[model samples]
Target chain A: MDWNAFLLSLKLAGWTVAILLPLSVFIARHLAWRRYAGKAFVEAALALPLVLPPTVLGYYLLVGLGRASPIGQLYEGIFGGPLVFTFEGLLIASIIFNLPFAVQPMQRAFENISEEIRDAAACCGMTSWRKLWRIELPLAWPGLMTAFVLTFAHTIGEFGVVLMVGGSIPGETRTAAIAIYDRVQAFDNAAAGAMSALLLVISLIAIGIANLATSRAGARRG
Target chain B: MADRPTGLDARLVQDAPIPLNARLRCEPGEVLALVGPSGGGKSTILCAIAGLRNIAEGRISCNGSVWYDSEKRINVATRLRRVGFVFQSYALFPHLSALANVMEGLGSGRNGGSERRARELLELVRLGGLETRRPSELSGGQQQRVAVARALARDPEVLLLDEPFSSVDRATRQRLHRELGHLRGRLRMPIVLVTHDLEEAVQLGDRMSILHHGQTLQEGAPHDIMARPANREVARLIDLKNIFQARIAGQRPGAGITALAWGSTRLEAGYNRRFAVGDLVDWVIPSGSVILHRRRRPSRGIRENPVHGRVESMVRLGDTVIVAVKVDAHAGYPLFMSMPVHAAERNSVAPGERVGVSLVRSDIHIMPALQPDGHDDANADP
Candidate 1:
């Protein structure tokens, strides 16, 4: 059943969400609140990976992190391993691909909070951090939950970006999606069906729980 | 109580093309009610004092500490200003219970008795049992009370209320007014109440400042501001509905009555202004100060101010009846007189009936017609 590939896929998805969840919230809040020159350009650049073909994004990441690239050379000079065709490379690619998935919902949530409540919090002697933690976080909890679930599912279901960037090294970067493809190519129908069902079930459970949780929160907001 | 130190002065020019310049001070245990028309920079004054707004060129200080000074480049953060603010919308935290909302205002130094303090504040606002309920679970007035309790939790040095009772029903507003009056006695801070409601301002303020556009037209005791407004606009804003334009004919120096010419009609009013004899003057008498008598019967007091007219209309608002009378000699609109509904019934006054209404000699307040360069030069009172 290619157990190593399935475990690698799960590990990748878990790490991606754990790291991106908090980071995206900060990014979302900054995008929601602050205004500066070139803000629109920066936002559009960040969201490019969402609309770009996954393979195209993967190609850019490959070039950006290849041994010939400055970052790739710096990393190789430090660690003695090329950055491409590695698990770390896959993780980075996953985060970029899922950028908009994580940010948009959280940004929308922060924007929906009334300005009166924000001013009231400031008048109540709350620092910016305290106001965000106490007032904004609680009210935007639903959007945050949606962001987490969408990012988790998107990471797990990823195939094109990881395939191009990590080259599907078995037990290293050969995620469950690659394993299913390999199984089909080898005409191993039973094993392919089993892995596909596992991925399907995982995706379904993530989406189902997100819907249920956000619906309850939505009712409270209403 | 001793005098509370204050030097809160601001001359802001950035909100619009014209600068809003207002200076307000409240001694210890007093409220300076800032009454003005809507868009008259009343709330802006409160916000500027609280450091919630940036003033282009001015200084604001409270209790001898500077909150904002443009010359020194000192601007204190809003939270550290230590001012309690109550917004018109109540601005309660929808997620937090009433107790938590109040406790949140106590900040990090709340110590161990936060719960007790919050409960006591809620009890003070008459919301003891509702402390556990979230703002969404409370009524509008209840939420307003929670906002007040939360503002007071920090024990601020200055209190600013921005039309705090505007959103509630009239009955609830009256109750809130009484509660605010009770609260005013317990807290001796420099309190500022910003409202467009003239009656509310006259009732609650120990001292009243009348504003228009961006300038403070007059500031004095409520009775004085009402009885002797600075200009035609101020007279209209303070609810003196019987303002009329008359040309100054002569001044009776000793008796304090100015002989005024209203079209072809001659009148005597208590005016002390130094304006020239040929200058135009705007004068007002309180609706209640107007005496009404049958046309056949003579006016009891001074005969010069009496106008023989026909009753044009009568509007009954609660206990008072507003009678509009068209004078025989006046070329324009009718004069308005308000009296008790019982008095109207007793006098048997009705629309189209002939009557004699006398503008009380002592009740007449006069000011120069608003200048063309004045902020409110358009002079559309209605």
Candidate 2:
């Protein structure tokens, strides 16, 4: 509801998108192109956050970064504090919560590319890195943009993961979604209405921008 | 007939089986066509030579250096092979402009001047000013031309094309073939092309290797293969339609000839060195070489081989007429004879009418009967 909470939400969403954009592309490409041991199992594991209850995911994150945990101990040794109740921790949680949403669309996009194109590149003696940079990534831009926008919006709308891992630390962890909950709990219906409207407008504009970019790219290709 | 460095030498052996086991030695300026049916491993040989498919055994050498050797554990990656490949689908990068697609293979150091070379190659293929256009914006023929230009941009030691004309229209395909002929003259790279069209193979290949079931059936000039197939399979594949079961009726020692009898039709043929007096053999005569006449003419000074028949059916193909003539009282089988449409018109031959077909003794080729598999039918001597 407050401007600080709104700014914190924006920052969390921004960082999540920044980190996940490249990571999701890698994941999507891996799932789309390569054959490896236990690939289906890894893909299913990546998708668990989409189907599993957010609170359950939050509980697992809580256990994993609870100071005494191995990851929590590693973070504490590096950053001199526990990862729980920190902005970095919330960002990590939001990324985990929105990964499947980010990766699935991009994976589908990469899957649609004909094997003829890959074979053509191979025949041309282009290296794998060259093919990825010059061919695969460019063809998959629209899907990548879709993943970015959807992940950002999904991260902003998240509530359960933030409540469990973020701990509502005001300017640090109390995101807009969490702030709206707080305002509703305090019976400040007007503030909640205004925050919900802002979230709705942001999502609409993001979707419109993504559509425009995709159509422009498609037109250029045509 | 001048000897030059053979363009590519590839020997591929995989775990399953050596699907491609060939030693091709082509001159630097010659076009060697690898023609076969689908899944005959023609493309596999090309890929192995290009360093695209890994061979678990055998060795590949191009331009006097070894590119791949399974026993030595030496394999050059595709990028280092300096071989150009044009795929059947014309794998032009959809995201790149035509010029960029052609320039993608040029090294960064050569990037500045490669555009001119790209344009030149494009012009060579008759795709002059479409450099800025993407692949999707071009027609199928233009796309294939762009792909060809891209392959030639590196001026590779050997150029490989996999069904280069398979995706284009007939007019475009003919044009592409002419362009390929011109490029072959200019580049002087040993161009290895894989094609399923027999006519295209015969037209384009200076020398050809006919493959069947992953094995080379025969390799020679296209006309040589057509006129004198090594076996029955090659004869059938080359469209020799008059194959019949015959017995060695007799042999003429001084004339270096043998007599053969098929039903009531008797013919004299050149004596096959491998034939014995009592050996039963299959004789193949190309339909195109058989001359058809409506009425029997007076015997000439020398009558080599002649047969009387009734025209059973006539199938017109373009400018040629394939006439299936029934010899003797054969139940349903007919001997095929091909003649130009003008010849058929002059003779006024029609189905169910009596006609006489004549072939020289040199055209009467005899070989051993094919095994049950019929694998040898297409390669038989004609």
Each prediction's number of clashing residue pairs: 0, 14
**What's the true lDDT of residue A26 in model 1?**
91
Per residue, candidate 2 scores C-alpha lDDT tens digits across B287-323 of 7667664443545623546667788788899998888
DockQ class, candidate 2: medium
TM-score for chain A as predicted in candidate 2: 0.94
Q: By how many angstroms RMSD does model 2 differ from the true structure?
A: 3.4
What's the lDDT for all of these models? Answer: 0.83, 0.81
TM-scores computed on chain B for all candidates = 0.90, 0.88
Q: What is the CA-based DockQ of model 1?
A: 0.67
lDDT of 1 by residue, B21-73 (tens): 77667776788899988988888778777787787778888778888888899
For every candidate, what is the interface RMSD in angstroms?
1.5, 1.9
Give, for candidate 2 chain A, the lowest lDDT window spanning 10 residues. Answer: A116-125
Docking class of 1: medium
Candidate maximizing TM-score: 1
- Tens digits of per-residue lDDT, candidate 2, A57-78, equal 9999988888889999999999
